[model samples]
Target: MTTGDRCEMPPIPLRSTPIKGFILDITGVLYNSMEGTDGIPIQGSAHAVNRLYSESRVRFLSNESTGTVGHVVGKLGRLGYTGIREEDVITPAPTAAEYCKRNGLRPHLLVHPGIRSVFDGLSQEDPNCVLIGDAEHAFTFKAINTAFRHLMKMKDPLLLSLGCGKFYQRTDGPCIDVGAFAEALKYSSGCRHVVIGKPRGDYFQTALDSMGLAKDEVVMIGDDIVSDVGGAMAFGMRAIQVRTGKWRSEWESHEIKPTLIADDLLSAVKACID
Candidate 1:
């Protein structure tokens, strides 16, 4: 479908066609915090997920750069989500690793230690490419300067950003995401960084390809209007926006629209199934 073919917050039907596959965002749609410390499920989210798990191919797509696929799976398990495996989760670390391997670029990683294992086989000797992610405590000025120096030496070095999210809701409050840093480097280095997660066509395409389903056959459910909803819509997939995490009133003014808008993930899934 084209960008003009948008469905704006349509009412949920009594019975709709069962979706073949589902692309779910973890941060807001599935759970609240990264640590899964928030008490209880978001109303009926658990029930909806459990029901869909039996019938549809579900994949958890996250922009979280601090953890590996295994780490995310473990967190989900702790939050009482059953039947989830490592393969069911897709994060930017693996995608970045694959991109670097395919292009024969040596990586200078600026990501969290938790996800460092994703690039295990890759060479880091003469690091020609600088890969940036949400390194949290490790994202010091020294680290950024170090990466900048490495980029200056190469004629056209690669800069890979895991996600370009402006900020994320942490346990305490909202915190800066990798996008800010990525933009800074882009301005300084004059190198356009290739974003590997959310809102990027290739990122959504990767998830769809893994499920072996066409874009039209799948639906993307998430809270971020730009990355999750707008990105999926741009990729020709139906999207549902949940009013949870980083949702704002100004999202309605954006050019890209969601097929439906639900109160939360449970409501969004209910719109999908019923």
Candidate 2:
């Protein structure tokens, strides 16, 4: 896939093996949160996703924390993708809670109230994991400092990251995502943070488990090479990267590579099935 807007392409190959389901990345692959790009219906995205649903089981997996499942479903409906159910979606936030519960580790959270809605089972009594989500306003230095203080005191606590974008593609250039703050905190605290979003294998495994599908029967389709392609590759599933989203050919020359690159989601979907 090359940079810049290119010509329209037809649907790509579906995998030769029967595709039990698909795990999708929401932000760049399905829809951009910000409006007003010369948005081209994400070429074959709706049709391919719908087609997959009609043909076999399909799951829409994302790392979005800004909205709840209902909100996401509404947005997807607006985009003309109607095959998904709320339960079919998977995110690291809820998964992390389950992960912690399964491991007998409760974590104290440092995230905003709105973001906590994504994780369903947290109670005040449970030990908290420092949960961070994206907010519209700037975080005060004092607040960050306080979080750092807690980070210093906790022993073997999990630092869970909400999938905040690292860099966003804008009219000017790539700008930092709020998640970069979380990244910085993880570095300063010398605590290993498990990023549950893109590029993380946890969400992938969760989707596969929910679908009752083997890794070989699923293909991951997305726009970002790191979150979509890298994550899928790590899970031993095939990946197809569309030229859309954060993957500019020149900017990220060697940092990440896709198993297959397509001009758009439709072409990418076709590749996945082939």
Candidate 3:
């Protein structure tokens, strides 16, 4: 947050329990989302992460529903990161698609076109489900109305929401996230949407599994206090909130407090290992 590419944050104190794995949030935690379809890496974050790679396993758990798993890995490398692996990255799109396949539900997908391919094999012939993600500008009135009609008319309505965070940070400014649109649909259709991404215990468990660590042996580092800190705590794991990305001062008073709060990722990494 100090400015430019690098941060000037100092190392922080640590907790007694040893943390062997990390679940990281991409957008606001690692870098500031910018134009050109990628983002800028936050100061010292790349270095801190690389250093952590020497000590512990890392899994990038993001509700960033846009890219394929490979693209997620590429995005990290393009942002100057070196320690992340393809399987270490977990996004909601593919996971949601797998859910649809497992449940035999054909989703009237309201997701971004970028990740729309993941649901390719599934039958959208008679979409009994409505799966929503960060569709950005694609959430037209017609689109929502169409999806609403699907849910209202279905014998059993199923709405799978990718993640429910209200908004995320971009270099220019803040923009509405998937949760806002998902809520609107829920209110209009009177159908409850199932959460598919962060804060969801199963999703956290998936990330935890990828790390081969139990909940107590891992730490969740992210920006959104609700989905990241609150969710991780609810899953019985320690969580750390960084004052970057979509971070707001008002959230500091939120009911769910982080195990520790830091200025940015650099300090969070230091605290993770200290």
Candidate 4:
């Protein structure tokens, strides 16, 4: 049954990234969207998380802006990932909020309604920058136009995009992600945009800072090649691309290769610990 045409692919290989902090992607790496809203856990993922706790300070870093950090923790618990605290989970929405606070830039929010509370304390009176996340249906023309107009009015005209992911897979199909919206606004407003989520070095730095670890001491694990693997590597950290999520065999020869590839989170974690 084995194909002779294949050169050779191993089950998993040990990565060279030293282990102090673990940065994991949520959507495809932990659980998949096969069973509706509450996605079914990928096999061995919970076990991998358990091992991560014993070995390193793990942070669930995701581009997910659909729900609050609290919601992500709850979902993790339901899916049998225990000992995870709210602070351990980082998403673009809250990160964006913190970015606004630090920079003293009031943002015109273009994010999901569920996570709007994250920006509650931020000044909205005179929004100077446009903060765009995956607003799902909120990406309507009126909304986008409003955001565009706001950006046009701003003297600086800055757009803070959540993540530059082009699309995400839903149960129905793949839908346009926040990156697309960010690009659209960028095109219209010609504003200087900063991506706030995965593949953004700052975002990974934020996660590492939260864990009190330097980039050299941390390893990023995710299913996405570009976001998880490519991003972390670019940030000067070791990255392990998992076979589960959005991974494809053709991408094995991508320009930005991972430090090593693993069969899944369990394998990726094992490589970190063992």
Rank all candidate structures by their lDDT, best first, as comma-separated numbers. Answer: 3, 4, 1, 2
**Candidate 4 C-alpha lDDT tens digits along 124-186:** 988989999889888889999999999999888999988888777655666778989898899
Residue 270 C-alpha lDDT in model 4: 79
Over 1-274, each residue of candidate 2 has an lDDT whose tens digit, in order, gives 3534633231223454566677777666765545344232455678877767776677777766655677777677777667667887765567666766676655555555555665556563444456665543435677666667667877764566766566655444555665787887787887767776777776788788889998778888776666677778777787777777666766344345555677777776765554
lDDT against the true structure, each candidate:
0.81, 0.66, 0.86, 0.84
Off by over 4 Å in 4: 1-17, 34-36
List, in order, the clash count of every candidate structure. 0, 17, 1, 0
Q: List candidate 3 stretches off by more than 4 Å.
A: 1-14
**Which parts of model 1 have CA positions greater than 4 angstroms off?**
1-18, 34-41
Query: Model 3 over residues 1-274: C-alpha lDDT tens digits?
Result: 2234543231222464788888999889889998677888899899878877887888889998877888878888888886688878899888898898898889998888889889899999888899998888888999888989999998878799999989999999998899998888888888867999989999999998877899888889999998998888889888899999999888766666678888999899997776
Pairing residues by index, what is the TM-score of model 2?
0.80
Global fold similarity of model 3 (TM-score): 0.93
lDDT of 1 by residue, 67-97 (tens): 8888888877877776778887889889989
- Name the weakest run of 10 consecutive residues (lDDT summed) in model 2: 6-15
Q: Flag the better candidate by TM-score, 1 or 2.
A: 1
Order candidates by TM-score, high to low.
3, 1, 4, 2
RMSD of 3: 5.8
